[model samples]
Target: MQALTSSFVSRSLVPTTPRRHRVRPLSVAPMTVCIDQSRKEKVVVIMGSTGTGKSRLSVDLATRFSAEIINSDKMQFYKGLEITTNQITIPEKCGVPHHLLGELPVDGPELTASEFRSLASGSISDMTSRGKLPIIAGGSNSYIHALLVEHFDPETNPFSKPLIPIELRYDLKYMS
Candidate 1:
């Protein structure tokens, strides 16, 4: 029995043991990875109070980056109020594509933050998907807040469901 055990141990330590397969080092360079053309664009949200030149700054930045502009201001959505709302000028919007600017009527129904968030998200998605940067420019505090912050706790506030719809609560909306 002792000799049998010794023979088994000797067999386990034999030099003819088969080796496991090893992974070959990757030869491809990291920089060679192709970037998706759809991801070339980004969304830049510019927010400020009235008369803070948000529109102008957005236009300038969009021009420099060859991006499209999306209006986030509530009043700027109405047409025929460009001077009153200080909306983007026609010349400023010439080369760059502008969305949701002067698209609604002055007497049109008021829009909730939830509605704005949906529209904004869709516009941003469309622009970014097409490899174009989407710049959100506006003076509305709530509009900026909705775009930049997350949600309020449902447990903390029982009325949270009614206070603001689920679609309205975004991660960035709670950041600020």
Candidate 2:
């Protein structure tokens, strides 16, 4: 039997016009979240386990709402490991801007939840300031929790100390 060559395969399978990947709405009923799109400060976060299509959903939402995507996946922060970490590709973004996705160096130090919160908050504020919606997507629950639950105001708490003797910190393991 004759083996098919690269030329034969390309000729047989490749379409004459390059086809773009189509984004389809999920068949399942949509979950409700309280988001006032009219409010510029409000952000949409897509959280789920790995391989649950958080990136896909974020891309779709970003495109629909003229928003930008901010990746919250810790593993996807560092450069490389695209396939292993399932980092979103440029084509998949469909001209939507993404922040904090594959932006860190491979050898960079490990990011703490606080750091992630800071980065994500900055991205959110920047997008909101410009009247663009901010869509955060990732599987990192701890990071998402930090971004959402923990409110840090330097102006309000100038000393940056706990209000009481007991620290008001997030215990993720206990919560999880």
Candidate 3:
């Protein structure tokens, strides 16, 4: 019985005959669109450690590229934490559009990576849709990673295997 089973398995693994190959003629022509580099908006994320002039560089680049600035520092999002957070100055913002900066109250509870990711992603999409470059400036490495890196899905918790908070979806929308 064992021998019979082995022989059957071996026979099953082999092809009965030589395989025939067929080549299909290609008919569809490739289409290309000429894009204007100037019109193509890009997202530039400036990230580093504290006091590294991340904001300054972002502002300068935004000014040169006609881009909008999105604040990525976790602390800089709160109002009245300017000095402590080293938030961008009004002069630096310089009439350039800024998003998610000083929007939350300082006393407000800590915002999670999920929350920040959502807000930043939204700002990026809005700016890009309007044909403006999105410049993400901040010193928070984790916040930057949340934006640029692919991590676990926000919807399903790996450990819990349960549905993630609905807010996570809201936050992820901005990520794209």
Candidate 4:
């Protein structure tokens, strides 16, 4: 086997056709691709177990994409427990806007999954309306799951039919 030299590379890349003549390498200028997303809604959700750099990555992405972060960690919902919950500090947030961080009182009861979903969804909607990317740095998998899926019962098999029939009538439509 013979090793390729720069001589071989330059010769191989040269125009081989008789009339084509040798043209120098194409000088491609840096291209800027701008997509018109005014009518589109976008959100980025980052999720992982603890200490996986989700927050850092979210901040970096938010900075680059002109985005804001939404806190999806259940524990981070309550104020005054940032250290305990491993929530990102303001400095760590890197001046990238963050939403739903420590909004609830520490002594207040934990928000139900439905409540979290509502608040997070509203925040994301508001950010998108304002032309900012919504970066969901999800600390709690359950909360992320609840926000994204229509029904996410852990006991339920996602691929299988629900044990409880959907058509079974109940006067519980008001909950919606």
TM-score of 1: 0.61
Total clashing residue pairs per candidate?
11, 0, 3, 0
Those runs of model 3 whose alpha carbons end farther than 4 Å from true positions after fitting are 1-41, 151-176
TM-score, candidate number 4: 0.64
lDDT of 4 by residue, 35-128 (tens): 2333435565666666655676677667666789888888888889988988888898878888888889988887977788788778877886
Candidate 2: C-alpha RMSD after superposition: 13.9
Model 1, residue 79: what's the lDDT? 86
Q: Per-residue alpha-carbon lDDT of model 3 for 1-176, expressed as tens digits?
A: 34522542344323455557432211111111112334433455555666545565556556656688888788888999988877778987767888989999878798877788778777766776777777777766567555654453446434455544322111221210
Give me the displacement of residue 3 in model 2, in angstroms. Answer: 52
- The best candidate by lDDT is 2
**lDDT ranking from best to worst?**
2, 4, 3, 1
- Spell out the clash pairs found in candidate 3: 118-171, 121-174, 122-174
Better of 1 and 2 by lDDT: 2
lDDT of each: 0.59, 0.63, 0.60, 0.62
Q: Each candidate's TM vs. the true structure?
A: 0.61, 0.64, 0.61, 0.64
Clashes of 3: 3
Deviation in Å, model 2, residue 93 alpha carbon: 0.8
Provide C-alpha RMSD values for all models, in order.
Answer: 23.5, 13.9, 21.3, 17.5
- Candidate 2 lDDT over 75-104, as tens digits, reads 999888788897888898899999988888
In candidate 1, what residue range of length 10 has the lowest lDDT sum? 25-34
Clashes of 1: 11
